[model samples]
Target: MSAGPEIRTIFWDVGGVLLTNGWDIDQRGRVLTALGVDLAAYEAVHDEVNFFWERGLISARDFFERTVLETNPQLALTFEQLWKLVCDESKMLHPECFEMIAHLRRAGSYRLATLNNESKELNRHRIDSFHLRRFFDYFICSGYIHEMKPLPEIYRAAIDISGFAAETAIFIDDKAENCDAARSFGMIPIHFQSPAQLRVSLAQLGIAI
Candidate 1:
C-alpha cells in the first residue's frame, strides 16, 4: 500500500499560545507568598506534584493534598482552597493571540486543535468564558485524557483523533521539551515566543499568517 498521506493539521498548546502571560513568574511568586511558603520549597513541591499529575499517577485533588502536606503544612489549607488559589493566580487569554487563532481558523488551510495541560474545570471556564470551542476542530484537555505534555501517548491521541499524519502536522508550544517531543513524533514543531516571531516562522514554512 502507498504511504499515509501528508498531514495538514496544526495542534496548539493553549497555555502559552492562547493564554499569553497567564503563567507569569510573578504570579507564581505571589501564590507562594499568599500560601506562606518559601519560593524554593514551593517550587520543589510543585515539581513533585506536577510530575505525578502529568504522568497520570494521581488525581488533581490527591496531588494538591500531598503537595500541601509536604510543602506548606503550616498553612492549614484544604485542597479546595489550594485549587482556588492556583486558579485565581493564572492570567486570562490574550486578545491578540485569540485573534491569531481566529485568523488560522478562518484561513481554512489547516486543521486546528488545542492540546492543553489544564484541569477540566479550568479548561471548561476557559472554553466557555472565551468562547474558544468555536475556533478549533478539536480540544483535548490533559485532565480529561489523563495524560499531559511531553508524553507521546497524548500527542498520538491528538493525531489519531484529528486523523492527520504526523509529518503534515505542525505543533506549536512554548516549552522546548514539549516541542522536542512533537518533533520526535515527526511533527513540525514550532517553538512559540511571540506572535510576530510566530508569523515570521509560519511564513517561512509557507503557512499564511
Candidate 2:
C-alpha cells in the first residue's frame, strides 16, 4: 500500500469533508418546526429528495418544488426561498479543513483538485469566498460534468487533467462508497473522518503533514 514518492495528485470531496453538510438532525428538526412542518413527517422525504437530486435523476427546480409541497404544504414559499434555505443550511466550510488544505498546498508535493457533487451556485460561492480555486490545479464539479461520483468517469477526468496515473493518485472522501470507488479505480483512497484523521492518514501515506 505504499504510495511511493511518485504520487503527485490528490482529489478531495467537497461536502462533509471540505464543507459541513446535513445540519445536525436536532437542528434540522428545529428549522422544520419554525417552518411549521412536523420534523418526523418530512424527514424521510427530505432525505430521499436530496438523494434523487445528487444522483442527477431530478432537476434542482423539481426537487425544490417537491420538497416545498411535501414538507411544508401549508406554508406559502417560492422555489427561490426553498433553494436559499436548503443551500444555506447545507453549505459551510470548516476552517480546520481549509487550514489543512493550506498546509498541503504549501508543501507543494501534490497537485490538489476538488471533485464534488454540488450545485453551481454553491461551487461558485466556495470558489470566490474560500479562494479555493487558487489552491487547486483543477476543480471538477458534478453540476458542470453532469456526472456525480462514485462514478469512474469523474475520477478519470480528474486524473487526466492532472496528468497523473490512477495508481499514483490519492483521493480523500468522507463517504466510504466514494472511497471504495477510488480504490476500485486503482487510486489510493483515504476515508476522511476529520481533519486530524486525514492528517494522520496522509502522513501514513508518506504525504508530509
Candidate 3:
C-alpha cells in the first residue's frame, strides 16, 4: 500500500487529534474554575445550548449568555473574556503532529483535511490562530455543516466533501466513538493516542508521515 490510490486522503480531528480541544470538558473545567463559577450550574446550561451552539445556530455572545452566565448571574465575565479562555486552551499545539502534517504536505502524497465539532468562532480561532490552512485542504467543521461526530451524517458529509471514496481515506480522532463511527462509514479509523503511535499506524498504511 502506498499513498496513491490506497490512501488518497487523511481526515483529521482538530480538537484532540491535531490540537487540544476547542472547548471540551477539561477546557471548560479549567476556565470555569478560574472564574469561580459553579461547575454543576455551568454544565446544566452548557448541555442545553451546546448542541445548537456548535451547530452555528447561535452567536458566541448568545452562547455565553445562555450557558454559564445564565446559570451564574453574579459571574461578571464578558463574552470576549470567556471566549478567549476557550480559545486559549487550544493553543497547546502538538509540535510532533504539526511536523507530521508539514511532512505530509511536503510529500504531496495525499489530501489533508480537518473534521471537527466546534462552534464557528472557536473553530475559526483555532484554524487561523494555528495556521491550519497551511497544511489542510478542507475544514469540515460542525459549525459550518451543523453536523457533529459519531453521527453518520457528518461522516458522509466529510467523505463527500473530500471527493474521495471513504475506503481510500483515513480518519484520525481521539475519541473511540468518533473512530468507531468512521470505521462504520468504511473510512479507516486511527484512534489517536500520541504523535508517535499515530506515525506508526499511518506507516502501516504506507503513509510515512
Please report the TM-score between candidate 1 and the true structure.
Answer: 0.80
Candidate number that wins on lDDT, 2 or 3? 3
lDDT of 2: 0.74
Residue ranges of candidate 2 with Cα displaced over 4 Å: 1-5, 22-30, 38-52, 55-59, 69-73, 90-93
lDDT of each: 0.75, 0.74, 0.86
Minimal lDDT window, size 10, model 3: 1-10
Give the range where candidate 2 is weakest over 10 consecutive residues by summed lDDT.
21-30
Q: What is the lDDT of candidate 3?
A: 0.86
C-alpha TM-scores of all predictions:
0.80, 0.79, 0.93
For model 1, state the Cα shift of residue 42 in Å: 3.3
The alpha-carbon lDDT assigned to residue 186 of candidate 1 equals 87
Could you give the C-alpha RMSD of every candidate to the true structure, in order shown? 4.1, 3.2, 1.8
**Model 2 alpha-carbon miss at residue 37, Å:** 3.1
Comparison by TM-score, 1 against 2, better one: 1
CA error at residue 100 for candidate 1, angstroms? 1.4
